[model samples]
Target: MFIEERTADDLALIRLLDAAFAELVARYGLEGRSGVGPGAHYLVAVVDDETVGCVAVQTTDVAGTGEVKRMYVAPAARGQGIARALLKEIESRATDLGYDRLRLVTGHLQPAAIALYESAGYRRTEPYGTYADRPGTFCYAKSLAG
Candidate 1:
């Protein structure tokens, strides 16, 4: 798998995101929500010319901070380290962009993702950013400073 930064509005990435959003909507009821918005950079995972997974990041209200968003891997692409790779790429890119810290919030609907974050050295943190008031949300954070 290859990961590269793309505009948040890339067409192929949009298609993959639509697929993921549809699944998330059915599972999490996140309807009428648009993704990433402007100013967020996206990382797309391409495998054999197919866009299988993606993640996005943007500046948070917190100074020197960035927030992870729109992270998803196609169901058929699971178990192949795509999510982990995406996480690593996001972290690396965030660090390179001068962000000293990164944070993300994933819902309880994804236990595996929670475990993945924990395993990646992201510790459970209190509610943060816009997710602070959302119930069933689990927040995690990692210091990206080297």
Candidate 2:
């Protein structure tokens, strides 16, 4: 698999994000939502001319940190290290974008995501975004500073 920077505006990326977001909402019984807004940098995992996985990072309103969003890999493509590779790419891009840290929010319903973040060196953080002060929200942060 190859990981490369892509635009969130790409149709393929949007389709992937939409599917992932729908699954997330259904699985967690939350409201529907789309991916991040413009100015977010996207990374896609491509295999055989198909986009199988994707992740994105956008500069948060907060200083010195970027927020990670829309991370997903096709079920058919799991266990192939695509998520890890995409995350590492995001970290490198964030550092290059002058961000000192990265933050993300995931629901406890997704234990796999929680475990991935924990094992990837992200620690619990106070709720951010719409998750603020909400129960069942799991926030995580990791330093990207050298």
Q: Quick one: best lDDT, which candidate?
A: 2
Model 2 regions lying over 4 Å from their true place:
32-34
Clashes of each: 0, 0
TM-score of 2: 0.94
Q: Write the per-residue lDDT of candidate 1 for residues 1-146, one digit (tens) a residue.
A: 79998886689888888887787788679642445757888999999988899998888878888988888898998999999999999999998788999888787888988988899999889997566787888888889877
For residue 67, give model 1's deviation from the true position in Å. 0.5
Among the numbered candidates, top TM-score falls to 2
Q: Write the per-residue lDDT of candidate 2 for residues 39-133, one digit (tens) a residue.
A: 99999999999999999999888899999999899998888888989999999999999999999988878888888899999999889777886
TM-scores for all predictions: 0.92, 0.94
> What's the lDDT for residue 6 in model 2?
81
Worst 10 residues of 2 by lDDT: 28-37
- Estimate the overall C-alpha local distance difference test score of candidate 2: 0.87
